[model samples]
Target: MKRTWFTHPEPLDTTTANELIQRYTSRQIQTKKTLAFDPKFWLVSALLPEYRHEPKPSKQYQNSIWSQ
Candidate 1:
């Protein structure tokens, strides 16, 4: 099986990046597989601050998650 990882080009604060890394890593472990993330994931998570829900797979999820 293939594994995926996501990151951003823009610089990130140490704390936030660490948090994201931890979250992604945990997901990888829970799924027993590697996960892929796109630039949009990073942008949405970082800029919006509302997309912390698991099993979220929609633009509304994106909007709601970031809205916070």
Candidate 2:
């Protein structure tokens, strides 16, 4: 994984890249919000259910959760 992308570089695709970035950012925001709301165990809030199944964040943080 380390420096491997340099050997087999991924093709440039801004559309796909943008979508992936947005989804990743959205999940990160959700994870942060979940932990903030509970402040309990951390890994439980991130995984164990699946990355795509992260607990939904509050409305204030949800505006950016799913891509428009």
Candidate closest to the true structure, highest lDDT? 1
* CA error at residue 41 for candidate 1, angstroms: 18
lDDT of 2 by residue, 31-68 (tens): 21112233332221112122444477668756565957
Model 2 residue 49 distance off true place after TM-score fit, in angstroms: 16
* Model 1, total clashes: 4
In order, what lDDT does every prediction score?
A: 0.43, 0.35
List the candidates' TM-scores in order: 0.34, 0.27
Report clash pairs, candidate 1: 4-35, 50-65, 50-66, 51-65
Compute the lDDT of residue 38 as modeled in candidate 2: 33
lDDT of 2: 0.35
Error of 2 at 41 (Å): 39
In candidate 2, list every pair of residues with a backbone clash.
none
Q: Model 2 segments beyond 4 Å from truth?
A: 1-9, 29-68
Measured by TM-score, the strongest candidate is 1
Listed per model in order, the count of residue pairs whose N, CA or C atoms clash below 3 Å is 4, 0
Question: What is the TM-score of candidate 2?
Answer: 0.27
